[model samples]
Each structure stands twice: as structure tokens, then as C-alpha cells.
Target: MAGSENSKCRGLRWALIGSVTLNLLVAGVIVGGFVAHDRHPPRPVVGDVSLGAFTEALSPEDRDALRRAAQKRVGDFRDMRQAARTDMTALIAALQADPWNRAEVEQILARHKARTIDRVDIGEALIFERLEEMTPEERRAFAERLLKGAQRFDKRLDRDDNRPPRP
Candidate 1:
């Protein structure tokens, strides 16, 4: 009947309108989530270091000195890393070469091991030098800040059993 056809058309139109409205609502929600996420990014966690907290406790002058020290240390570290990479690459090639000599590989590995140890020692020495630059009071305060941060980090871990520990 003509009446039945009219009813069917009306129903289809309403269903289409409802679907369009829902899709627009969902799109709005998705856009909102993205905006919100961008505005409030997660904070970086660096183990128990609390580098930010330690820096906040320092005076402006101390902070400037610390920045300079960090820049120098980073530059040195990059140079060392590059050298290490080159050495490691050479070692890998030697190890992979056809008809490799065990004695030669062993010698190369021993030398590489010594070089790596030296690099670690130098890095630690740099860190120690920075520590020495700070006053005893500053060092004590930094220790306290590190402790509090660790406590806060542990409490966050307790909130969810299924979640793995954060670095």
C-alpha cells in the first residue's frame, strides 16, 4: 500500500539521521581526546635519579654551572661513544671474516674489553667530578630529593598489580 511505503521511508530517514548524529558525536569525542592528550603529556621517569628535583634545589648560579658541566660531559660522551662504535664494528667484522683466527679474535676482544672499561671509568670520573663541585649541603639535599622521588614512584607502582615497574 502507499501508506506502508511512506512509513518505511520515514523509518529509514530517522535511522539515517540517528546514525549521522552518532558518528559526529564519536568524531567530536576522538578529537577532544587528542587535544586533551597533547595538552597534558606524561612526565619522563629516569629511574631514581630525580635530576629535575635535584636541579630545582640548586641556586641559579649552581644551576648554570651544572648546565655547563652537563654540556661538556655530554660532548665527551658522544665522542667516546663514536669511537667505541667504530672499534666494535671493526671487531665484529674480524669475528665474522672467513677463516677467522681465534688468537686474533681473542686479542681484539681483550683490547676492546679494556677500552670499554676505560670508557666506563672515565664516565664515572666525570660524574664524580660533578659531585665534587657541589657543596656538601647541596649533595645532602639532592640525596633527600632522590629519596622522596623514589617513595612517590613506589606508591604509584602499588596502584596497579598488573602494571610492570617503571624505569
Candidate 2:
């Protein structure tokens, strides 16, 4: 009778241990799947448009100015991003070298603060201006469609920060 009771106690302990181990394994698998999904999600398919056709509607000089401004903005944004990457790399290395590397981190953050990049909503402005030129009924219809698209776009933007601007 004592032997039987001892055996039952050992069996219960083994069952509890097994259950705990299985739970941990399942949790690990779920976490790994989430990380993998985030690392390699499907790329979006972007359609191409003609630059010539896009600029055809504007005056020659205005079109040229717009093109130049767009180029400058893109270049500025790229330079800032490059600088940010460099700063982050240095900060990471510094922190790894000494966990309390506050000075280096602060210096990098200061540079980021000084290099302020302004985001332009040029496309949004252009769309609004063009819509304003249309007749009231036409404008209302265009606005309705635009609102629907903007809502969808906002939702997508919320999910993926790198979505391209619509033409």
C-alpha cells in the first residue's frame, strides 16, 4: 500500500513537469513564428507611372522648379537618414563597450535634434487645389472618392510606415 502511494506521487510530479515543459515549448514556437513573420513579410506591388505625363499638365518653368524642389527634399531626407544610421551605429557600439555611455548617446541625440527635417505634404496640397478648381457637383464626387481613398491610405500608413505616396 505504501509503495503504491509513493508511485502515484512520482507519477503526478512527472505529469506536472511535462505539462510545464510543453507549455513553455508551445509559447516559444508562437513567439518565434511572430518574429519570423515580422522579419520577412510580403513586399507590396507598386505600379509605375510616366514622369513626363505627370509633369505635362504644369507650365515648363513651374514643372522644372517642382522637380528641383522634389529632388532637393529627397536628397536632404536621404542625408539625414544616413546621419541617423551613423549615429545609431556609434551609439550602439559605445553602449556595448560601456553600458553607461550616456555622453556618446546624448551627443548623437543632440545632433539628431539639430538636424530637423520638415515633412512636406505636397501631393495632398496639389490634390486639394485641383479638387477646388472642379465644379461643385464634380468636386463633391471627387472629394467623396478622395475621402474613401484617404481613409484606406491612412489605415495602410498606420500599419506600414514605408508606403509610397500615391500619384
Candidate 3:
């Protein structure tokens, strides 16, 4: 019957739309996360990937300068990361406590997330300040390196996800 056909067509159309929307959302998250994460050096995680990114584009002296700048603030970053770890530990412990409360967990998570964001903000500020002092050529080269690094990261993620290598 025409009505049956119409129903099937409607169902197919909705399925197609839903699939496309989901794909778009996933792509947006991937792109957004990549850009935000790529803006900084990797976290000091045990399995962190090394981008070796901007150093190839920099003069020895400039690279040294950047290294020194980062070195100077390493302790500060370590402290911030430690604070985040501490907060996470406390959250986990509370989650294990009697009478678990969803509201309390949400509040703790939000505060922990805010602190993490603040740490990133501080890191970005430092990088931006360093870039501001760089020569125009250096800034351009660094941008190129960052783009390449991000692309490499994307490919690695795709491989991990068992997706086809991007064209």
C-alpha cells in the first residue's frame, strides 16, 4: 500500500538524518578537541606522544629560549597537575563513601573541571606570551608545525579507533 511505502520512506529519511547529525557532532568534537589540545605540549602522562613540533622550525638559540621558559614554569605546572590529581582522588573517595549523592558528585566534577580549565588557560597564556616575543618568521613556522602536529595526532587517533586512514 502507498501508506506502507510512505511509512518506510519516512523511517529511512529519519534514519539518514539522524546518522548525518551524529557524524557531524562527532566531527565537531574531534576537531574542537584536537585544536584545543594541540595548542599545548602534551601532558606529562606516561604514554604521551611527542610532537617534536616547533623545534625543527626554530633556531637552536630560540629553541633553547623556549625550553628555558618552559623549564622555569615546570614546577608551577606540576603543582597545578598535582592539585587536579588531589581533587580527583578526593572525588573518587567521596564517590565510595556511604549514601552517594549525584548532586554532590556533579558539583565536585564541575569544580575539578574548572580547575583543569584554569590550568590550561595559564599554560596558553605563557605560550602566547612567548609567541608574542618571537620573530614573525618564527611565529609562522610554529603555526605550520602546530598544524602538522595536529594532523599527525588525528591520524594516530583514527588508527586507534580502527578507522580508515584519512585521505
Better of 1 and 2 by lDDT: 1
What are the per-residue Cα lDDT tens digits for candidate 3 across 1-167? 99999999799668645644553565567568669896878654322211245445455665565556666667766776566556555666666779865567567667756876776675566556677898888778777877887788899988889966679
Ranking 1 against 2 by TM-score, winner: 1
lDDT of 3 at 89: 58
Best by TM-score: 3
Which candidate, 1 or 3, has the higher TM-score?
3
Clashes of each: 0, 0, 0
Summarize candidate 1's per-residue lDDT along 1-167 as a digit string, tens digits: 99999999799668645644553565567568667987877532211221444545555665555556555556555675566556555655665679755576567557656766775665455446767888888788767776887787788878677687799
Positional deviation of 125 in candidate 2, in angstroms? 8.2
Q: Which candidate ranks first by lDDT, i.e. highest?
A: 3
Q: How close is candidate 2 to the true structure, as a TM-score?
A: 0.33
lDDT of each: 0.61, 0.55, 0.64
What TM-score fits each model?
Answer: 0.42, 0.33, 0.48
Q: Give the lDDT of residue 85 in candidate 2.
A: 62
Q: Which stretches of candidate 1 lie over 4 Å from their true place?
A: 1-67, 70-79, 149-167
* Model 3 clashing residue pairs (backbone): none
